[model samples]
Target: MQENERLARTFEEKRPRLHAVAHRMLGSSDEAEDAVQEAWIRLHRSDTDSVENLDGWLTTVVGRVCLDILRARSRREEFFEEHADPSAGPRSQEGADPEQAAMLADSVGLALMVVLDTLDPDERLAFVLHDTFAVPFADIASIIGRSPAATRQLASRARRRVHGASPLPDLRRQHKIVDAFLTAARNGEFERLLTLLAPDAAMRADDTAVRIGAAPLTQGARDVASVFSGGAEAARIALVDGSVGAVWQSKVRPIVVFRFTLEDGRITAIDLVAEPERLRELDVVVLDG
Candidate 1:
């Protein structure tokens, strides 16, 4: 086989696995795809004859690209809040099927990502690659330029932070909890739903123009459930990635998104977002229709 053809076959075999790794590392599927494409460009440009362990090499390149993208996004989210108007930008926040496009919203859980955001880019990369996806510490070290032992330590630190932020709820149970919460919410069983929530619970949506408070924050789950329960008819529910949630659709406008939060088995928070902005950076049409 020709060298390029051989390289292409190897690249194709490894690409999907690498994309999953990158997606978990960076929290955006769109960004993950970009990183993988960039990795292919780098791979083909290099002299393929000398490269060994093409899978590892390609994964490393993709990991680096994801890291760079994370760093750039972090800076934008930090320094450019004033200029961060997604509504006015070229991207249109038009049609979004919340269940389909929100990778972070559906899988990572809001609390995990918020803590992950605090990690330095390399630490976040090392931790997510090793712990979240089970990439070996040695391979992770190769990607991050650290010794395997040091990479292990980095991962440990990040794990502690994630665990401290939110105890790792069994993902399966969490999914079940989401379904129950959504049912309770849509049915307006506010009192029954209160039993499912931790006394102090929180709800936050990123598309909003202002920030809201954290938990211990509410005593009455009934009151909290009112936000979502009463409007159940306008929304549609779907189980995306094992969690039950809803999207508000209307013929005249784009979709509005909501993600439910469950704690101690009760529906405690519902993050309601109707802002036409932030939906665009998310690269999803807000499918209200």
Candidate 2:
């Protein structure tokens, strides 16, 4: 096969993973889609003869695109919001779904897209690529143009800011936590569920979704537990990517996927990917009883 064909095949194989990385980084289905497409465009345009590790190259390109977009977004937000009234627009709500319309007010919740707004572009990219997506430090380094050690340090600092704990909970323990949450939710024991969550937990539902009356992202263990007890009709908790998480069934079908970001044995952030088009990537499978 010619070099271009070989590169094309390689890109095709890694497409899904690249899209996932872009989605998590950009937090917008539209933006992620655009970034990945841009990466592919770059790949096709560049001479592939000298390229080694096509996946790594594509990841780097996509990451850089995301960083540039993030930086531009920051500048625009500062320019428009700085001189505007504090209440010029709708106030951010706590526990609102991370989806575009809900726009939670808390700094840790979907509002965190803004807190992450504070990170330098490289720091943010390393953190998301390594911690969330489980990308290796070497690959992360390639993306950020840093050495592996430097990438490790950058990811570490990002983790600290995001409150990610070291010596992450093993998969079995993660399953146990999910089981505990499932049990508490099923029994309608709000207080017990709260005990399983950290004090400053933040909830995020996909803010860009158009689903009518979708449940809001609930922040804090206590508030989330309350929402679970009051709102959940039936829930199925399962392991996805070695973590304990649950999906809510609305009208006899799985409608929402919930992923918990844990720190020090308590849930720190709850990310709900509510966009129907993006549900498959979230791994919202219905585990049989």
Best by TM-score: 1
What number of clashing residue pairs does each candidate have, in the order they appear? 14, 13
Cα lDDT tens digits for candidate 2, 75-188: 766675566444232211111123321211121123345446457778888888887777789887876678999999998898787674333345445556766776777788
| Model 1 Cα lDDT, one tens digit per residue, 1-289 | 4878887888888888988888777766666778898998998889867767777778788888887788887776666555755443222223233442345455665345556867888789988887767778998888778899999999898878777764544444554565566567668787656666666556565534234222323345555555546446655543322344555555543355556676566656666555565434332223222
All models: lDDT?
0.63, 0.65
TM-score of each model, paired residue for residue: 0.56, 0.47
Q: Point to the candidate with the largest lDDT.
A: 2
